[model samples]
Target: MLDLFGDEDTLALAESHRTLPGRFGAGTRDRAGVLSALSALSQQAGGAEFGIVLGSGFEGAPDLIAEIGARHRLLGAAPETVAALNDPFRLAALCARLAIPHPAITAGPVADRDAWLVKRIGGCGGSHIRASATGSTPPGHYLQARMPGRAFALNFLSDGRRIEPLALTEQWQAPSPLRPFRYAGALARGRDEAEPIPPAIEARIAEAALRLARETGLTGLASADCLVEGERWWLLEINPRPGATLDVLDRRPTPLLLQHIEASLGRMPAIEASPTDATGAEICYAARTCPAMPPLDWPDHVHDRPRVGSPVARDAPLCTVTASGPEAVTVKEELRSRTAQVRTLLEETENSHEFQHERPEPQRPGGTAGREPRR
Candidate 1:
């Protein structure tokens, strides 16, 4: 078993092996490296149950699956349908095929430098994505006219035929006139803060997603990233796997991860809305500068947290702090206050001597017993 991103517990569930390089970044060379790694891992883990690949992690693994070629040819309908549903040269091609209204797009790369976006033809998580300045375009990529307006991501789950929307989150990117827009975090907008999705646009997105599933024979969880300008909804990209909001899905009574696993095993459960409807604004607060990893000396109260020596990076996920109340503003304020406390605690831990010399425990299966954070 080759579990690329597996933690100790996850590894215990399968036969673990080494990881392939370039699982995170985007570039022709890196993408190629990832593909090669996947292929090697697949060959190594022959006859294992279905392989679940994340992001560029899928590169070559599919080839290793015994019947994957036939399965993809027979079951992978959405990818092919999306490819043929629209002409790469025209924006209207997608709109016509999906029966949705969108900002007009040219079929090919825009000749004018300021009017086009050169984007990857695959999934979207802010990877391998870029906007073109007319003449500066990458080869072998899809080009479409850029749509103007704020961006919104609607996260949902599907059971082949039935689709259940979880939440519509507003994405925030740092205001950088010089740098390409990068996804920072998501905000759970309340009634006042929530941006309303018109029925027409919602219907269009849902229909397109369903049609995609039907075409591709997708049977489990997936997400669609779309842009909303005025009343128009423009399809951005579709992810065949879980999205960044997987943690949000974890808050559900039956975690989306479990659901996906079950679906993959051919046990499709009845899809339902998340058990918890508590909603306010949820935003990912991050450091504008590098924040050092804090030591683990939590009080005896908090439990089941990461160890003191866990390696955390700038963009690597730390922990998600959520707040909810009867109203949106109150929840937003609560989350903000809570996040500040977390940051302060982390900073204090960094400055403390305990963090500098604490030795992490040996790797153990479900070894989180005493190491959990005491909040």
Candidate 2:
């Protein structure tokens, strides 16, 4: 995955690992650095089938991919589609034209700031969202009226002509003083479970996905976020890229990326039988500044780990914890237990006298802390 977080350990998980600092896109100031990274990725991917772009840093994916001068195919939507969907105002307009129900959205700086939210165009994680009253009408920002409901997302594949369901995930966020509106994790719905959304509402989502794909030239793997209220639902945004929830939903015998490639080539594969168990993943963030993050003999559930003695600021993620069970309750409990244990360990590490005596090195710039490690 061409994203911010590094899965250096998971190079074996896939053929390519063209990751760069994408946390905030600040550390990557030099155009030369990005060019160098892509050049290296291409070199590593000799005779490779294609290149896939994921995550928020690629606001200019169309331009960047073109400039990178890739030799292989580029999977996912057209550059024009990506650019159009990245703009919330344009997206809302599209939703209106398609009769897709969306939150009351308008141009920047609404008069009733308290009732709306300020969100960044092309923003991925919830981190870029802010209460309208607290935010200015900055460039690339728009307002959507705050809707009361739990957050949910649907992962689907499109073959330019048809849409296929992949999975439904419940999105979680832990807003705090340090990392307000932080993406905490997502829980995949089980086969024998009740979805947060009703069947009728889900049908609307499927219809919307197909229509959006038809209008926007969206193909390959993508996700659509929504706010579900009882029987009614409002569309939040559509991400026409490989999603972070793929880890939980992708259970086909064939690798999901291959299917993504097939979809891009205008083919929709039949959904194969897979795991019926509920799977959930969470991002465990540091509650306080930890000067020393010693590597622990983490259990098998842990992934996307930080290096030992890594100085993590308060609210930055330490690692990801995943659990599987027959139901969401058990999976959620397991995640909570593991997350609490890790947080305790982090607190202990911070209090150690070795940590106090040790002079920690400055953190690397342009990293997502611990969020969105897709590889």
Candidate 3:
């Protein structure tokens, strides 16, 4: 298999991995580089047939997908379907038509900046979201009134004709000063086990997802993020591609990626949610800048390892940690413990390296260089 190898985690997953022409970030900035990389890889494929299955970053940019699909097959939603699902106004209208609760959104103006959030179009992760009061909205962004509720996502697989519910994930935030709603991690109960949400709410969300998929002809794995308060809920947005929960949900005997390809081809697999351990995954961020990554043993639960000597900036993602067990509460506790362990390990390693590299004072002309300064 071939992949863009955007991070170290993906670097080892594919037989042949290539980097894009430039750094990849949220929004529409990296489309050209993606096209260039795909062209190069396609040429080297020696006329072999291959299809594209995307993750989080590309769902907001259907034209880019169209450009990529022009040369190769796309094993996901069509460009029109993507445009329909991703457009904020269109989605709001669709929700209204379908009698689904949706937050008020507008691209034109915000009467109360404090009441709304500025979100970049096609932006995944909480980094791209900020209060409208923070700054003016840039191009390819919109304003949505902040909803009051806890965050949740329903992950599902679709085949254009039908859908299968995968898992219900409860998401949380890791707030920084600037990024108060930054995505921290998500937790889900064991497959086939009782989800954290009420059965009524789960049914409602599943129904909404199925209806939205039919309306947009959505195919492959996707996630629908929402906010729920008591029995009331609002659909936030649809990530029309594989989402972050893939780590926790893709544990079946048949790999989900292969199933994704089949679903995209209009064939739905008979995927029964088997009973499995509850899983939790979180993204750990660096607390300080590391000029060079120091060598240290990463725990078994830690993943997305950066190469030694790679510079890690303060507040940047350091790595991901995952945990799984028979119960959700214990799994979450384990995730927290593992996250702390990884952070502490990095801090100690860096400190030890600094001490090892410390330079001692040399003897001065007066032979008092090693002495402490006298008050």
Give the top-scoring candidate (lDDT).
3
C-alpha positional error of residue 166 in candidate 2 after TM-score superposition, expressed in Å: 1.1
Cα error of candidate 2 at position 347, Å: 3.9
- Candidate 2 lDDT by residue in tens digits, 128-171: 77888753567766788899988888889898889988888898
Residue 148 C-alpha lDDT in model 1: 74
lDDT of 1 by residue, 170-254 (tens): 5555333432554444545443443456767766777777765555555556666678877767776555555555534455567
Instruction: For model 1, give the 10-residue run with minimal summed lDDT.
Output: 366-375
**Sliding window of 10 residues with minimal summed lDDT for model 3:** 366-375
Q: Model 2 residue 337 lDDT?
A: 96
lDDT of each: 0.48, 0.72, 0.75
Backbone clash numbers for all candidates listed: 11, 2, 0
lDDT of 3: 0.75
